[model samples]
Target: MPTPRPRPSRRRLLLQAGAAAAVQVVVRPAAAQEPPALATLVAQFAGPQKVREGRVKLEIAQMVDNGNVVPMRVTVESPMTEADHVTEIAVFNEKNPQRDVARFQLGPRSGKADVATRIRLATSQQLVALARMNDGTVWSDSVDVIVITAACLETTTSS
Candidate 1:
């Protein structure tokens, strides 16, 4: 019959666990734990092209009693003709679970580049709206919204 191996001591087991944890701490990178910057998210959506400011308008309240349903309006200055028109409109939020809030597609036949809708805000944070033209030029606008009552976050606090 083969001989049985001796069980490891409690102190030896604890020392091995501590060494493993230290190795993990040394191997993991710090930046990987951080959330992506809002600008990075915007750039990802806009593609590799440069993004300009203007020709886009975003309207939302600076302060609100509730974030469950906040009114939002975005207008892009475009003639809405076959030669010149807004191609797409997208909304992004800083504090939401996801960076993108909504996106809308349009064309010259639409006759207008204005959109009105309601979006949920997690808390007090910034919201960015971007519009793309037929020629591939992009325009943007941003607004800060304060939510007295949060819609996405589990807890809320007012500043």
Candidate 2:
């Protein structure tokens, strides 16, 4: 004969319900809020909260064979001098789970405001690169890329 399973007690059921309710209360607000857009992220990145639409070069392939790891490079046209140099460079993606992709810090001694890296894309979308200068001015540029194989997309198996 098969052994019967014991039923949970009333107190145990109440405790579980209370815990679930607490979790819901904590998570509801976050779920209701939408993620910040790329422009908003750029504004937050800029020290003075001002952004110029160009002067930062964002280089990426127009079409990517795979989205798993796409090569990207950002080069800002700056002298990289003590009085005028690039302070930071931030990369943001439109369709990714997280908007911010990468951030590179540089100073006058660095001699250059360029960065190269591989980033994963969730899908075909536009990417923005913003550079903050030591003079408190922010510059930005964007590129559109088509990804054949998307990254971070969940594939479901049929039972």
Residue-wise C-alpha lDDT for candidate 2, range 1-159, written one tens digit per residue: 999999999999978976864665565564342235875786688756678987799999977868999999999999999999999999998888878899999999988888999999998777989899988889989887777678978668999
TM-score for candidate 2, please give it: 0.72
Every model's TM-score:
0.73, 0.72
Error of 2 at 49 (Å): 3.3
**Which candidate number would show the highest TM-score if scored against the true structure?**
1
> How would you encode candidate 1's per-residue C-alpha lDDT over 51-142 as one tens digit per residue?
89999999999878799999999999999999999999999988887778889999999989999999999887789899989898889998
TM-score of 1: 0.73
Off by over 4 Å in 1: 1-35, 154-159
